[model samples]
Target chain A: EAGVAQSPRYKIIEKRQSVAFWCNPISGHATLYWYQQILGQGPKLLIQFQNNGVVDDSQLPKDRFSAERLKGVDSTLKIQPAKLEDSAVYLCASSLGPEAWETQYFGPGTRLLVL
Target chain B: AQSVSQHNHHVILSEAASLELGCNYSYGGTVNLFWYVQYPGQHLQLLLKYFSGDPLVKGIKGFEAEFIKSKFSFNLRKPSVQWSDTAEYFCAVFSNQGGKLIFGQGTELSVKP
Candidate 1:
């Protein structure tokens, strides 16, 4: 079985620019998650979607960050007018279900650098 | 707010040496704990998880974690670590009620041959 897939393994942009990332979850997985990992810090959840419906996104900065899971298969996260602090690795993960016992499979991640 | 804490930022050891990594979480309700490892240029992979029942949970690659509810801690341990075990390890917690996973600052482990 193939793992979660993400596009644009890396990107570099100046501050105040906009950027977007794409993610394709593993087949048959029902839950998708997006996380941001700053240097020397653990990955922090940005948003979560369960079959096209948002499960959680309290940590997401609504003013600048937005994400959507279209058709419950692919997801896109966007940051408009990015800041230097937005420089981080964006990781996508998928799980078989939303249950607590389910294990999440992660993608290679998209590293973004905002100058 | 829920949070996970990894006590060590980095650790160095030789092959065949014992390994133990500390993790502590702050949550009053039920939570699911996990340990994830990321090798150089590799994605994050699960090492172990603890849900209920036995406190000692074993995972892939000779790794195990002991969950102590009283202390709100889940610490990863390995009897004998190989050089291949060198990686960044993160401790995470999932809130059963909120349906969110929170990760701690990673601990980078270096093993010498």
Candidate 2:
């Protein structure tokens, strides 16, 4: 019954530096997703995983961003050589399944600031 | 490409006033619509969702949304708003073929007590 958990509620880094965020999804959830939300904008899906396999990552910046869910319970998203444009909140969410009607549970996002 | 649009960026109203927030999506295929609310300092929570059947779906906290398939619109509404209802609302869509959600820019609602 626990909500999705994320680490390091806020982070600050200089441009070109690297940063990482972690997420622990709800127990028994089978699908996880990472999203980026710029200020005043809606969340944009970065990647999605069903268990340990990636379901979609078409929006992920292959040159700078990467994510992994090794055990299918926890996941990490990393951004290397961060840019000012990467300053945004990173949100993690999970669902019971990949069904379109499944309800998604979101975690408190990690707010990042790139100087 | 799939996209969601929220017409209003911000709105303020006195308590007990009626409320309506417009949302439109661009996708021709069948979709599952959702309305999520984020209170200050909280994570996004599902207000309601529409998959099939009724066009009018009622959710928690007296919130409801009407899904119009022809126009591809899902507008959230409340008959009487309360200050506690102040929050950011997002409209999202998931295609029947995929589980990923496409979200709107969001609407911030402020209800003066």
Candidate 3:
């Protein structure tokens, strides 16, 4: 089966610029997540969606970061007025369900560079 | 306030050498453990996971992990690592109550032929 899909493997933008990353989860997967991974650090969950409703966004920087999984299949994450600290790889993952034990499959990720 | 910790930031090893990477988590309730690997230019892939019923879990590409609940640790191991094993390994923890997955700072493994 095909894994999760992400667009624009890389992006370079200056601070205060806006950038958006897209993700398409695996077919039939009901749980989708967005994570940020900085250099030398592990991935951190930014948001999670179960179908079209959000399951968690407590870690997301709501002032700059916003994500939506409309129609319950494809999702998009946008960073407005991006900051240097936002330079990281944005990873999208999907699971069969929202259970804690379910395995999550990841995408290649969109690497963003903020100047 | 749950977190995961990986003991090593980087490791250099020769081919055929045994490998072990330490990971520990802090949580007060039942949790699930996972080991994910990302090769150069590739996405993160699941190496192994431990939910219950077994302490020793084997995964793809000759990798394995042992979940020791008492120590709050889940360490990855390989008997003889190959040059292809060079990659970044991340340990993560998930809690039903917390409703989130937490990852440790990854360990970069470099294998010499």
Candidate 4:
């Protein structure tokens, strides 16, 4: 009954540096999501995965941001050449399914600060 | 293609006072609404959700929200607030199944005991 888990609760990197965030979903959860929450703003979904396959990533920045959910249990989000605007909290969430009504459980999130 | 707006960015009130936070979503078609709360240094948690049925949905921690179709608004309210209720609240919307959730900026509530 553990909740979603994330690594490196906080991170700091210089501009143009590469940063990676990791997430581990709840046990038996089938759907996973990554969101970016800027200060004073709500979390914006960056990508979503359904059992090792991407369900939606339209909002994800393809030019510099990429994510993968290999084996469908754990996922990683990477931002190459990070910018100042990329400083935000990276949140990972999981749900029982991809249905609209499913309740999503969220992790503590990784707060990234780009210098 | 959905957006949410929160009327208030920050609110402060004494304990036992009534609380209300306004939220509006822009979606013409059928939609689902949600209210999530995040305590200081904690992850976001569901306060309540609306997916048809009753317009007024009650959530945990004595929080409730009413969906007004005409106004396209879902405002969270509490009859009596407490010091423990201090947190940030977010409003989100989903227009389709498996779709990404669109969220508002967020409202930070501070309750002084």
Question: Fraction of true inter-chain Cα contacts (below 8 Å) kept per model?
Answer: 0.89, 0.92, 0.95, 0.78
Q: Model 3 scores what on Cα lDDT?
A: 0.95
lDDT of 4 by residue, B41-60 (tens): 88899999999899999999
TM-score of each: 0.98, 0.98, 0.98, 0.98
Q: Tens-digit lDDT track for model 2 on B39-78?
A: 9999999999999999999999999999998999999999
- Measured on C-alpha atoms, candidate 2 has an lDDT of 0.95
Task: List the TM values for chain B, per candidate.
Answer: 0.97, 0.97, 0.98, 0.96
lDDT of 1 at B93: 95
Q: What is the interface RMSD of candidate 2, in Å?
A: 0.9
Pairs clashing within candidate 1: none
Tens digits of lDDT, candidate 3, A1-115: 9999999899999999999999999999999999999999999999999999999999999999999999999999999989999999999999999997788999999999999
Q: List the residue pairs that clash in candidate 4.
A: none
Residues B69-99, candidate 1: write the lDDT tens digits.
9999999999999999999999999997778
iRMS (Å) per candidate: 0.6, 0.9, 0.7, 0.7
Candidate 2, A1-115: lDDT as tens digits: 8999999899999999999999999999999999999999999999999999999999999899999999888999999989999999999999999888889999999999999
Candidate lDDT values, in order = 0.95, 0.95, 0.95, 0.94
Candidate 1 per-residue C-alpha lDDT over A71-92 given as tens digits, one digit per residue, 9 for 90 to 100: 9999999999899999999999
lDDT of 4: 0.94
